[model samples]
Target: MKVRFYFITITLACLVLTACNPQTNQIEKTQAPQVIEWEYQIAYQRGMEAVTWSLPAVSMICMRNASFNLGGGYNTVYWLSEIPTAKQEALTANNQTPYANVYLNTKNGPVVLDIPPASNKTALFGSAVDIWQEPIADIGPAGADAGKGGKYVFLPPDYDGSEIEGCINVPSGSYQVFVALRCIPIGGATFKEAAEYAKNINAYSLAEINNPPQGNYIDIAGKHLPTLPDYDFSYFGYIKELMDTEPLQKRDMVMGGMLASIGIEKDKPFIPNDKVKSALTKAIADGYNYLEYMFETPGFSLIKQWEGRQWMNIREPSNDGFVFDEGEYLLMDERGSLFHWATFFPRHLGKATAYLNAMQDADGNLLKGEKQYKLTVPAEVPARDFWSVIVYSKKTKAWIYNDLGRVGLSSYDKENMKLNDDGSVDIFFSETAPEGMESNWIPTNGEDFFLLFRFYGPQESYFDKSFVLPDVQLLK
Candidate 1:
């Protein structure tokens, strides 16, 4: 009996030893190193995509906050009396037109915009953008009135109200909408006259239009507004704020899941552990690097308009509303790249404007401020309304500040500029104006800058790849 008891006790002791051994415990509790590494990598990749995909929304939130800080919050219009000068706080602005805008929140009910009729040479060109900066509708010109101007109602996504007759209905995809208006000074109208016409533009809730208050106008000219997101881990904070403000759609669920994986879900406190924080930091850096590379190396082929001239059309020719494949699957990467390079406003081919940018000079070198260059714009620029070329800082992506205080040259000012014998206009870019070329000079302030060529109301020539801009040539 004692021998039998000794054997049983020995067996129990062996079992305990097996359970307590560190190696055995590790074998049961730990995952394979490869598995853990793969999980981490997947998390990192999703984090990167989340940041890239949410850039537009984050940009909207940043702009909203900046506008609020600049004294115009929700439901108020901020009017720029003059064209955006170098000191104007904006992501990217043009000196050709006076700007006025109002941020609308239609959560409670529909908001009514009373766009005054175009008077004389003053006309308003407006566009309504959702939270993602997707073009909801063109407001003034290229809208239902075709620049005649009329009352327009912006309804929320969940709006199920009776249709009101006579008013153009603009159904928005999100609760937050931005009505960006530009006052074009045509027919020799002055900027001040155009600004006065912009000030007459009114926006108010349908419930309060009968007793509407005087329009709140916050002049943002020469004032600084921080519209760009902080390019760091803190950028996630802006994303979180955007998620909280804008309701997520069914298509955005995947993005929401990705954001949640990085501890940035809506209504949740974003308190990430050290490991997660480190992973997110690395992901942001990787995303920026990848996007920069993608911008430099054109992923989509450019439709060469002229020999040796490459102009990239941001929108896909076949697709209109959404960027989808033949299978109807969303091209997330392509969409992300387009928004990263330019603004979030995506319009249809015909009603929309086209943008072309050049970072390098003709000699394949970065455009430096200290160097002198010339760009000869071909005659008969094919734009229905107008066209302009604006120089911006490569770093800020905003208008370059210079001693001259000029940000752009427009076709409207063609009379003042000298045209070549062939009718092409030569534009000069230099720190100092070339002799007898003050009218064509665009100052660079001795800092690196890039060019943005805008074709507002682009015609068939632009889409057919018939119109091409000349390269910037280095002056001898």
Candidate 2:
């Protein structure tokens, strides 16, 4: 499994220490070592590394391609006029609120994102990310504008900070940018009503900021949108496209160089030969399985939210935004595992929202479909907006398909859901309702699943760990 680079590293280290001869007491002129022959194992190990490196970028590409498929493109705005359903298959997508999304291409020049301020009826909550899924700016009240609304200019790598006036200027390293936001119903307004009010937000070329064309808008609510990355030789195609399209980051020079060994290069047309194709196909599968193993690993110190409970936060609460950038080296696995189950990395936490995950039950067993489980939420929740417990299939990281067409339960369903004598709520997960608990049930549909506890507008207790959420307990 040793690649040519591995041998080079070893050989260089040996030369530095052992190349000095005792007889001469001097450093000898070293002869160049032969490069190791390439093989499937070499490509396999490198491909796995590439998957970890490329997951974030590839996921962004998947959504951007979906944007084009939905009759939208760079600068064309699309939104879910209603809450998302299973039909919208992006990773761990929220089913609670309406979503508005737009992709921007800054290859030619800068792009302008015009966000409307928090009004009487509607306010937006979300972030804009570069193609790497790195947060560029946060939107809405808790964001860059602080709810007053401002024009955000996405400047390209080549653009200087000159003559750009009266707007938030965001300098982006990658050429492509994705902006996604949720429409929050405000001042007693309804969710759907707020979606209509969100039409005021728009993105266009900075060249036409003065006379921007009437914005393009499409409602992708009921569409069967597929935004998951492929795990085959085709995955390399995404790498090739980015190589041809965007600038190679300084940090990624090593991975970019390794990609060349497997037939992906910017200067050359991406036509993989039989040998490269065979190596890549197997590499992707192995890479994905390794990532799956990382995701399923329990009690990893970073993801554990509550010390005593199985509830986990993908980004360690103290580490905001999951950058994993330690200045010495990028914690690739931390970033990879986080994006493995979710998309749309947020800029901040505990102010607008907080997400905690649980794949195992109280006894430390993986959540299963054939089994029944129940989680009890305390009477006092820290979310000012709302709290929801969502279930997604472990295989797809997407919503499960059940006859009831339900994915999760939220505080919004409190009236229909039965509560304990103490006012705490019991939400069940099984093939069917737990006797009279039909209103509180989230169906598993015979598929192994995981849970996402979302606290929207989470209060201080959530951050201070005073409001501890309980684990899902197995039912007899």
Report the number of the highest-TM-score candidate: 2
lDDT of 1 by residue, 258-377 (tens): 788767888889997777777778888888777665555555312333456543344452345533333455466666665565553546544646777676777667789899989998
lDDT of 1 at 105: 91
Model 1, which residues run further than 4 Å from truth? 1-43, 299-304, 321-327, 344-346, 349-354, 363-366, 383-386, 412-423, 430-439, 456-465
**Top candidate by lDDT:** 2
Candidate 2: tens digits of C-alpha lDDT, residues 249-278: 888999988888766889798776776678
Global lDDT of each model? 0.76, 0.84
TM-score of 1: 0.83
Positional deviation of residue 410's Cα in model 1 after best superposition, in angstroms = 3.1
